[model samples]
Target chain A: MGGDFPRGKSAIAGLATFGVGEAPGFSSMELTARAALLAVEDAGLRIDAIDALFICQPDDFFAGLSFAEYLGLSPRFTDNNRTGGSAFMSHIITAVMMLEAGYIDTALIAYGSNQRTNGGKLATSIKPNSWDAPYRPLFPLSSYALAAARHMHEYGTTREQLAEVAVAARQWANTNPEAFAKGPLSIEECLASRIISSPISVRDCCLVTDGAAAIVLTRTDRARDLPRPVVPVLGAAAATWWNSIAQASDVTTTAAAESGPRAYHAAGIGPADVQTVQLYDAFTINTVLFLEDLGFCPKGEGGRFVSGGTIAPGGTLPVNTNGGGMSYCHPGMYGLFAIVEAARQIRGEAANQLGKIDVALAHGNGGTLSSQATVILGSADTL
Target chain B: MDGMTGGPEAQWRAALADGRFLLQRAISSGTVFFPPRVMEPGTGETDLEWVEATGLGHIYSLTWVSQKPPVPPYNVAIVRLDEGAQLMSRIEGANPETLRIGQRVRAKIGTQDDGAPILLFEPTGH
Candidate 1:
């Protein structure tokens, strides 16, 4: 993300930031209300302005009703873009598309589920798809297993480097009370944290806590009359490979390789322009894989790029500043939060802000290791 | 758990003959969903209708997995079928030596013990 592109305050006239919301992990309804209220309050708009509704959680036990009826979202455009973890971003991407096509403005994107409070039964009972329901790969854990095995087999990546990503996120999480994976998780502790999948341990996986977050996207003309006068959708792109985990061409690469370029081009920037990055970390391998796929480093060198505190706080391109999904709370809501954090960082409001507020990248992964979506956010000055 | 060959066996074979292994869902206007979903993705309606894929496709990208992966190494790829649907499946029936980007492939039904079918792509020899 290099170059100070052209951007004006008018370009983001309708932008606003809904205060990030979390709820008492009782049920999906509570999380929904929690996020909706924050979004409503943050935008300084009434709950009724949301003309578009998108939800990633498409299961009954979580939402307590069919999506449309459950949320009471009476929007013209609706999407439960369940591309996977990035479903939230997919929802946001859909909103942006609708806005560009003049489909609708003032859309509300929300995601909330309880793996911790709900006894983790919703995920276990609900099968991902017809092909996978039978196999029932532990998903994030097993999918990371595929990448762990590939990285170890191919690039001579050690277990320690992968652990570093988790460790760094935890260290940063201590500053943010909402993060689930806080506390000092030394490499030794991580190495011993119950091998969920080979080369990756329990801590390497996202926590099962329940939380909800919502963002309000309005027409550029309407953002000026909001709580946050800035923070607009700068650029977004999505890419998908066939979703056969076992049949992927390269475990180390991802659809981000394709999506990242498109997003950068749309934003009129390059990888180097990003000051912060919020990579989806349902598993450490994804964070690691995307570091390369998004052009942070050359292919097959993600392990190296992440080593030696390059992505840690006070390091070059400090990533996952708000603890990411690994330490933040993976509850499948990390995509929205990651984008939220990137927006927050671009606005210079993160707990661990590093450099000048310019460009930030948020990448989300979905469907076994195949689908990917990337969005680039930048400041008006740098735009 | 391993795949067994039984009742899921017979029905799967017949479905393969009928070319029912091809999946269609609402997730996209692009390709078949390998793992079928009850809903047509983007549409909340449970309007998922199964349709037979064109079965004819070109090799968009490929790799020769040298050894067993989680199960063992095998050839895997993203095949762009004539319907413009991209599917990721094991590339069987052709030697790795002769694989090319534009290689024509035929959809093959892989049957398991329980009579369920798994679709795998194989290169159609010229």
Candidate 2:
């Protein structure tokens, strides 16, 4: 074992294109379609070459759309899956399975939500249609606020450390032209934003935007003929939690804590070998929690490690080169953006290119921090 | 499939109301269920009954939302009642400002004007 994790495929070639649809640019659907078109163009192929399509599921209230008919996609094998924010990266794992099984030739995965349309006001929080009742959406900010509180109580991590994460994200956003929360964000500002849940302010939450992003994947053979360099899937994994918050073994650790190691082993690489990373940032705490859970640093050291400027621009690993969901465009399934950005940087095409990245890590999660998917990408076509 | 009472909106309101909540289901093949139904979720068993619980449970998990939750930062938690039934409820007694997990919480009963007896949980100060 090179480090600790598993080694992935030697060569599984394919071109995965990502399109961010947000802000002064376009609506969720409009942006999704545009990205699909552009990805096809980037692959030097026609849209018809896309035999399969998977969409990041959006709540009916967010995008005002439901499943079935794939909304505008006419793919021979089109389907939409709604797992959570991690649904985007989870699609990549599914795509790899389809490719290996030879289910279809080319596939495209798209995620779009008019977070701005709903203004992030997801309809009823209570279970709907089912025997479950209804209530205004009482989402993660509060849910996560609880978890963060427990973490602080158990580990004594300071709220200032959490504020640091928000501050860092806004800092990265400043460098990102398309970032929704870009520019300077003071600690006082983060501390001042209306508290959504205990310990979490409005600024602590991700930005809601009307946007859609897509990633196109083809067989290794077909990807070789594409215009831009193709990044291969070295390894992938996923996991889910038990019942509600009460059933979880640990509140601070997310499903990623379980999935990250599995993906690493499958890829035959350890956390230390990952040159760059794309940790899903639904909340700043998630970033720090996964940082430790993914083995980037020791547990509970997430606050200290990050406080030392480890995830910043000049740090050992530069995350969310695209500014991440916190600053970039969350749009619900912000995880997909993480996967796309990792691939871009590995391909040396990222706007915020870091050092020569040989391998990259992309971790995405869904549900109430319930589901997780971890993926590994490489700079070379074949390992 | 059990039907919603008053409506989805009302049921949730009832669920959140004090002493106005009660969920019961017969035990078969093990496991407590809310809203007694004739058919199981996966088995479709036509053997189900509704039974009133003792309405006493331990706080399984607790979270202290800073301000009111986006919806209302009140106490939201899963209480595993003594009767082996777990339900979501808003808690009181402890400050919403300093609630802790694994604390002893007792269910308090009250009635809504609509005559529905609401159930709420509060810290036993233990």
Candidate 3:
């Protein structure tokens, strides 16, 4: 993979978003088209300049081809590889490979959903024959709560540690006007919140808002020509261990165990070099798992590492600087938001900008801790 | 084993109706899998057979769906079956939050909303 791009690898040229909250009357296709156009505009390119496209959606009705048709794009390459929340991060790696191979010049990856305003449920309508239907597993959250319970049993992870994740995210969210969580959150309030699942309170879960995001990727040289500061795609990797929680070989450890190290190695750096981390926080346990599996701390010590406001606004490691899914906007699949936030950090344009930041790492978790994708991004100075 | 025609799913479902839990084991590799499948996961061997499990296991993990549910505040659990297979089932007659990991559980035949046979678990102590 290193030899494939000895010099001038792919870089993120533009990033754009739409409707962090309540885009009433906009269908998923409409949201997708608007996001794609905004990304191309941000890239300082015409909509027709895009030669490749990718779209992620919660439903199959709004397919990638339909989005292309709606956007009037006849791109040479297209993909709808939906890996839940990890889809967009996975797309960055796929786009990199295609850009290096000259299969496509400008790749546009976008996602949009009205899951909130549309009143959509995640898996209530899963195929009637699913093994999970009878037991009534509450979509993804229950499965994650179960994993959190196991982690607590094995590592003595306390409920307060989980509440801290929500508190830190709220602190970051309070800084961003676009964040859904409007006020400061206290650990006491987080612990007192209603429990959606045992061991996972409402605060521990992400916001169910409507939103969309997009990114433009091209070769490094091509990115230099774009309007915004070029953020090089230092590294990107993806892994999937299982689709269902019941079948997961090990629930405590996720695919991040594989993708995290691979992404770091591809970037020729390690976790310590990352100034800020944009990790998936669909649930508090997700942050806990990624921190440990990504080697930020010794395995099972994530509870200790995250205590004492370690990941809060002024903490040593600023994670989910844009309030993350917990406090920010989690329209649905949150993978793209991590990349969007990482790019913002690299470009020094984040709403809650951190000091002395050069390298940012974005990690995504999909399904019931089933799929994982890690992306490493750096400022032009690092490039 | 060579003539195993119909997939193991139907057989397993049928066993649930008869108050027995069925698991599939790879005849060659001796690997056990729940929610039975046709071929072994890694080896892709079709030499699979249905075996009656001890219908007993310990809770590996559990969660209470406090939200709207088929039953208010029901317990969902992943039980490590005695046959070395793990599957998700509902536990009856136990406090959701009070349920402890590693507590012993036993399989019991149950019916879903449509009266379709399914596997569930309950605390052996209860």
By lDDT, who's the top model here? 3
lDDT of 3 by residue, A216-297 (tens): 9999988898899998998888999988787776788999999988888888889999999998899999999999999898
lDDT by residue for model 1 over A1-383, one digit each (tens)?
Answer: 64222222122222222222233445665565567667767778777777877767634442423445665766687775667777766666667667766778777777766656566553433343454333345544555665666676678777788888888888788888667667778877777776654556776776666676777776655675666746765677788885666546566678899889888877878898888899888877887889888998988888888888888887787889988877777665568778878877766767777656778888888777777998777675653
Q: Each model's TM-score, in the order given?
A: 0.73, 0.80, 0.94
lDDT of 2 by residue, A1-383 (tens): 33232233222232333334344444556556666677667778777677777775565433313322334445556556566777767677776677667787788776665556554554224332222112112565555665676677677777778877777776667776666766777778887777666666777677776666667787665676777676777888888884344445577787777788888877777998988888788887788788888998888888777775567677666766677878887776687778778887787877677857789898887766678888888865445
DockQ of 3: 0.80
Q: Which docking class does model 1 fall in?
A: incorrect
Q: All candidates: CA RMSD in angstroms?
A: 9.2, 5.6, 2.4
The DockQ values of the predictions, listed in order, are 0.07, 0.28, 0.80
Q: Clashing pairs in model 3?
A: none
Q: What is candidate 3's CAPRI-style docking category based on DockQ?
A: high
- Model 1, B22: alpha-carbon shift in Å? 16
The full ranking of all candidates by lDDT, starting with the best, is 3, 1, 2
Q: Which DockQ value does candidate 2 get?
A: 0.28
Prediction 2 global C-alpha lDDT? 0.66
Steric clash count of candidate 2: 24
